[model samples]
Target: MRVSAKSDYALRALIEMAGRTDGHPVSAEELGRQQNIPHGFLQSILADLRRASVVVSQRGQSGGWRMARPASDVSVADVIRAVDGPLVSVYGVRPEAVEYNDSAEVLQHVWIAARRSLRDVFENVSIQQLADGKLPAAVTSRTADEDAWQPH
Candidate 1:
């Protein structure tokens, strides 16, 4: 599956926020500068995150943005969904929602299984884990295979 730049930037911004020791809201400018995300694109990402309740915005001198809940409660999947949409889609429709002819009926299962595999990693990984630079054993184990690092 292809990961969008929006999802990558959103996760990077959230990880930065999660890593902050101070309980201060991070300004968009600061987040953009730190994460190397374009300001305009980041603004739209932040807006989407805010609308999804993944992040909240504050207004004023001491105001900025903060997670709506603990970073541990927000998964990479959640961040991606907030900024993008469903994890897997066929022509904008969900894998299961897509109809197929007899010859292609089995292809739907491929999409569904692919989505499940993605969730196995994305859903299990939280922003806090990323911020702390510690991935779950389940994830690490997958990377242990030598072929995992090799390009397909």
Candidate 2:
């Protein structure tokens, strides 16, 4: 599965926000600067997050953006979906929605299984966990294998 820069930037921005303890909204400019995300692209990403209820925006002198709910409640999968739609899609449709000929019918199962595998990691990880620099054992265990670090 390919992870887009948008998703990466969104996650980084959220992690920065999750780490804040001042109880004040973070300005987009600050988030962009800190995360090294392009301001224009980050704006669109923030807008998407707001529309998904993953975040809320405030206006005024001391206003900016903040998570709509607890960081622990927002999963990586949730953020990905908020900005990029479904976790996995083939030809712009869901894996299960695709119809294949007899010879290729089994391919649908591959796509579905891939989606499940992605969910196993993405769905289980939360922004709070990332902010705290601690990943779940289920996730960290997978990285214990030295081969996991080797490129194919």
Candidate 3:
């Protein structure tokens, strides 16, 4: 499945923030500059994250945006969902919401399983782990096989 640019940008922004040691907010423009994302686009993404309670916005000169919770408590899945919608969707519909003909019914299960696989990785990983360049065994193991990094 293809990940949306918005979700990718959100993850990058979160990772950048996760690396911060000063506990100070970072402006959208700064985040965009650091991640090479468009400033306006980053602002929109930040707004979405704010509404989701994933990031809080601070006003005035000394304020900007910061994670609402600790980096360790936020998962990539949370940031993605906050900026982009569900983790996995087919034809704009959730896998479970789509029904198929009797012969093609198994396709729905395939989609569901695909979503579960995505969840297993995204949900299990936290921003802190990402910032620290450390991933859980389950995540690294998936990439243990050379074929796992190859284009299908």
Candidate 4:
């Protein structure tokens, strides 16, 4: 599955917040600079994050955005869902909801397994881990696979 730019920017913006101390706010401009996301796009992404209660916004002189919860408590999947909705889909429908014809009966398991595979990584990875440069063992193991880094 392809991750949308919206999800990508939201993740970056949140990571910017994650990199900061708890309760500290970082402005969109700063986040954009640090994350290499565009300022205007960051604003829209931040708005969605704010609406999702994933990030809190402030007004005035010291105003900026802070994560609503501790970074460690927020998973990458959380940010993805907040911005991108369902993590996996089959022809635009949820994996479980997809119906397959007799000839494609085995496809159901394939879709379910695909979503499960993605969740295994995305759900276990937290923003704090990414911001702190730590990765879950599963992710590390996967990345460490000799061929994982090879461009297919």
How far out, in Å, is residue 138 in model 1?
0.3
Scored by Cα lDDT, where does model 3 land?
0.92
lDDT of the structure predicted as candidate 2: 0.96
Q: What's the TM-score of each model vs. the native? A: 0.98, 0.98, 0.97, 0.92
What's the best-to-worst order under lDDT? 1, 2, 3, 4
- Residue ranges of candidate 2 with Cα displaced over 4 Å: none
Q: What is the lDDT of residue 17 in candidate 4?
A: 80
Poorly placed runs, candidate 1 (over 4 Å): none
Please give, for residues 1-152, the per-residue lDDT of candidate 3 as tens digits. 78889999999999999899999999888999999999888989999998999899999999999999999999989988898789888888999999899999999999999999999999999999999999999999999999999998
As for lDDT, the candidate ahead, 2 or 3, is 2
RMSD of each: 0.6, 0.6, 0.8, 1.5
Locate the minimum summed-lDDT window of 10 residues in model 4: 15-24
| The 10-residue segment with the lowest total lDDT in model 3 | 83-92
Clashing pairs for predicted structure model 3, backbone only: none
Better candidate number, 2 or 3, judged by TM-score: 2
* Candidate 1 residue-wise lDDT at 65: 96
**In model 3, what is the error at residue 39, expressed in angstroms?**
0.4
Q: Residue 101 of candidate 2: its Cα lDDT?
A: 98
Estimate, for each residue in 105-137, the C-alpha lDDT of model 1 and write its tens digit.
999999999999999999999999999999999
